[model samples]
Target: MTTPLPQKSFHDVRQALLARQEIALVDVREEDPFAQAHPLFAANFSAGRIEIEAWNRIPRRDTAIVVLDNGEGLAEPAARTLQNLGYTDVALLAGGLQGWIDAGGEIFKDVNVPSKAFGELVESQRHTPSLSAEEVKALIDQKADVVVLDARRFDEYQTMSIPTGISVPGAELVLRAQALAPNPQTRIIVNCAGRTRSIIGTQSLVNAGIPNPVSALRNGTIGWKLAGQVLDHGAERQGRALTEKTSADAARQARAVADRAGVQRAQPADLAAFQAEAGRTTYRFDVRTAEEFSAGHLPGFLNTPGGQLVQETDVSAPVRGARIVLADTDGDGGVRANMTASWLAQMGWDVWVLDGSPAADWSETGQPAAAVPPPEGHTEWISPAQLSTWLQGDTAAETVVLDMTTSVNYVKRHIPGAWYISRTDLADALAKVPKAQRYVLTCGSSLLARYAVADVARLTGAEVFVLKGGTAAWITEKLPLEHGETHLASPRTDRYRRPYEGTDSPREAMQGYLDWEFGLVDQLGRDGTHGFRVI
Candidate 1:
């Protein structure tokens, strides 16, 4: 018989947050529903993705973790999974997500609530300067001495950007703002897909004491669209490299800001000491541009560009009270790491920046390899060519194919007649699909699908084979593709469409997103556990 797991009440979790004690409040639901409503710091750990993401997210096996689920029935199984995977202190919430609601815990909408709310807090406290989208448009129309910087990812900038704006992500603002607008007479405006990045990026410039007058493009591209202003698509503009003196100066200013925010500086010895503490969870990250990190980075340090690190802190460091160390090879002080540390410190993290300059031998290169567990059980595999032939012929009726790729990818391109399902939800999802004499599973690379082979084989009581190389292999063979929601065996709970994203967000939604962000400062106050402070 299984032993009953320990349970933590809503008061227990709140106390831990308020006291700055270590506790990970994990929501074991998929992203879509989790985004719709959850407690402020509850990190989303989807039931299907536990194996692939757990090790990196919660590095310390003994760290306290509280798993919660609504009516989804995932919490207990997830807690068991964590225990099986060597997590020693995993438990269930006292009454689950519903319990939290009943106990008066705040339910927040959207992903990255902690970071987004902190951005709002920063703006409210500092009263960061801003220019309306209309005003920025007029400046551009008049060919005024103004430079606009987009503080989002480059692909996001390319999709749609303010006219004459160049990509300069949040952390890069301090490092490159002066280079883009050297003249003090020039006005600098920072914009993002929405408000968070712009507010943070604009404040970063102000914190660094950049000579040019800096302000955020009020409400960003959404505001531009709302104001009936046009945007430039496929913009490839970027800021130039900074000189050694300029880089050093930026680092100094960033370090000062981080100091004001109470960020700690760690030498190599200090990092070693922190990692040696068995009771603590330490996350080491290389906070540089992906391209720069790929060229070379320190061993054992995962690469998450600084701007993205701030935006997705919950994803990167799920253990709420863990210690985070940021690294960058930006000369001695590392402007990127320092600036990133400042924001993280304000967001209530015990963040550190490496003090010493990196040595010549930065050994590791390329993206960090994923740690995928071996498949559930041994199974035969069918090649893409063979599967394609079967699909075109009579055997198609006897064979059923399952696609475990993300819904977004499944919608873009997938095998003809392939049904998409979340592997973790297979039991319920499989009942929807017609059973056949044989079953086949495939994902982007067959990496995740192979794990589902045993599950499907047992469920159907039929011959099961994994598609070799998965869907990518089929695409490589130039096989015919089908798009959209062709055969969905499961609800598309893997993705949550953001209110501020895409070409045609309803005007109401865009305004509502802004309105939600505007009220976050008050929400944070009412929640009272964030511990955020703007310097």
Candidate 2:
């Protein structure tokens, strides 16, 4: 039997925060439930993802970590997982989320509370200029000399965006703004799905000393919707990659801003030394466009767009005291890295920008290949055609099919009698499934399903098979599909339902989201645990 784990009262955690010490208040729930309500400093280290993300997120083995969930029975298991992974200090919140509330701790809605709160702090301190939805709409209606820049990922901009807004993303804002609005007289407005990126993007240009007048589209796309303004759907106006001269200029400017923000520069040797440190967690990321990163990137470096990194710091790096290294190879200069490092520095991170010279030496291109292979003597793939034949056979009732796609996607479409199960809970969920001679697994793509073949086999000792090419391939072959949630072996808590993601979210939820953000400062004041320092 597992030993009883240590526990921390909310007050103890609060005191630790007040002391300005490093503490990772982790919520072990999935992104969806964690986003609904959590402490301001809580980092979501989802239960199913602990093994993959724990090392990078919590670098120091001895750093204090407190895990919690709303009585979902996930915190204990998460704590045990950390202990097994060589984490020296791990504990659970005494009463989970409710304990914090009973202790008068503030609860925040949404993800990336640290970054979002810091953005609010930046706005309050710098008074970042902004225009309401009505004002911006009028400017477009009158054909004013203005350019609206969507400071969000291209896919988000494609989903729904302000009319005439160009997809500039986050870190790309400073690099491409001058070219997009060459005339100094032309006013520039930056926007995102919500307030953080819009505020940060606008402030970034102002901090870099751009020539044009910059303002955030107040409250972002959420504000636009609340104002009853129509948004453009499937818009594809994206900023082009920076030119040679433009990249050099951007590098110089970004380096200067980083210096002002007290961000350090890391050489290849310095990075090696950082990794060699005995008890520190270090994350190395290439803060460039996905395409640029895919074309070529440093070994051991993950790609995270600069703007999104700042917007989702908690999600990207959960350990508050861990070191972070940012890199970019744009025209022989790490411009995006420097710019991204500046914001992270201001937000109280020990961040560094890497030199761009070494990036050219790596000849390898495309995503890094996975290291794990299928277990020996367990290689079997069932084509959609074969699966269809089985479904119509005499033993059809004995062949069990499990769909591992997202809860939302599973609800939208699945095989007629396929049972929806969480990949993390597959072993336990098998007890609920009727005994079958064989089990078949499938997802949106077969990649994840293939990875699960060994696990399913180990848990049940049955004939397990992977659906070739997944559900997408089945549709290509004109296979019939059933819609809606017909069968579910588990609760639909694996994915978070974002108000900004779907088209049919209520206006009240959108306004409530804005209202929650507006109150973050006050909540931070009450918590007194957020160790944020705006530069």
Candidate 3:
């Protein structure tokens, strides 16, 4: 028999937030559903993969955890899973999501609401300088002395960008802006897919005391599209490598900003002390480019480029109030770490930059710690060769392949006949599939599929098998793939399509996205639970 779990009232949760207490308000639903409606600080730990993601996200076994769902019946089971994983203070939100709503809590739509709301708050407090899309487009038409820089990732720049805009991702704005705009008179405009990165990036240059006039492109590409301005597709301009003097200058400015923001500096001994803190969660990240991190990084640090770290703080440090130690060894001291930590500090995080050299602990490559092994269970696995034979066999009609991948990846490519479905919706969607005697689960890699096998077997009462190595392995062996939206077993709400993410977003969606962002400040005002304090 199970013990009756404790319950947290919405008012109790609000008090915890007010006190800045260490608490994890977990939403145990699919990312899509979680994005549709959730409290301001809720961290999504999707129901299906709770076992894989819980340990790293909530490191302390005794941390206060309140799991919730919108009548989806996932919270109780998720709470039990947390208990099984040695979590001591796990409980369910009384009345789940609905209770929070009844208690006058505001519901926010979208993943990373905390980070996004903070961005709006930053703009409100700092009034970060920006240029209207029409003004930027006019400057481009006149071939004025301006350099437009895309602060998002390089791939994002490649999709759709302002005419002649060059890719100079996040922290690189400080490191490479001088080289890009040699003339001090050149006007600099920084942009991202949307508001967060643009605000943070443009403010970074201004905060760094760059001689060039700096401003973010208002509303980013979305604003440009709404202004009836044409965007350049397949733009290839990239920021050149930073020189030694540039690196040193950037380091000096970054350190000054970080110091102003009261970011702490931690040496190896300090880091050891942080790791020993009882009931405290600490995340170690290397804020450098993926290439640099891949070439060499500290033993235990995960790589999240400095720019993305600032733009997606909620994703990077989901355990709100966790201590974050950023490490960088770009041969220019801790410039990258300092710059990234400065924003995180301003965003109300307990962030620090690792000091001195990390040379001794450097590794040529690093992989994340392995996930806890799946519990003992009845699971079956099928090799790619066997799957191929089955696909060609007389019983092929009785077997169904469900590819549980992001909607974007599903549209890009998948097995020729596989149906796309959210792992969380497996039970409901199974009924929609053509009746089958056998089911094979697959994803980009087989990690998620492995987790889904047992539940699928019990739900459908069919022989369930995981496709070994998943779809990637099949493609490696010259198998055929079908692209486009052909076989969708469920609605494509598993992933939210950002207006600025891809090339061909509908214009109305772009306008809706901007409208949604414009209202965030008002929403944050109503929520009042976001303890965002901008420095």
Question: Which candidate leads in TM-score?
Answer: 1
| Residue lDDT tens for model 2, 1-535 | 8689999999888887676566788998877788889988899876765655676567678888999999988899889878887777899999999999998888988888888888998898899999999999999999999999998899889999999999998899878888888788999999988899999999988888877999999999988988999999999899875566666667678888999999998888998899888766788888888888888878878788999999888877877767899987746366678889999999888899887455465555787654332333555888999999999899898799888887888889888788888766777777777778899888887655665677788888889998988988888999999888888886787777667665667998888888888888888777777667666
Sequence-dependent TM-score of model 1 = 0.97
lDDT of 3 by residue, 1-535 (tens): 9788899999988888777677889998877788888998888887767777787677778889999999988899889988989999988999999999998898998777776777778888889999999898889889999999999899889888888899988977888898788789999999987888888888888888988999899999988887888888889999866777777888899889899988998888988888888978888988888888888888767889998888776666766767889998848757778888888887777888988755767775845555575744766888888888888899899888999877788899998789998776677777788877899999987777787877778888888888988989888978888999998887886666566677678988888877787789999889776766666
Clashes per model (N, Cα, C within 3 A): 0, 2, 0
Model 3: which ten-residue window has the lowest total lDDT?
367-376
Each model's lDDT comes to: 0.89, 0.83, 0.83
lDDT of prediction 2: 0.83
- Clashing pairs for model 2 are 32-496, 59-281
Clashing pairs in 3: none
**Candidate achieving higher TM-score, 1 or 2:** 1
Best-performing candidate as measured by lDDT: 1
Residue 311 displacement (Å), model 3: 1.8
Q: How does candidate 1 score on lDDT?
A: 0.89
Candidate 1: 10-residue stretch with minimal lDDT:
355-364
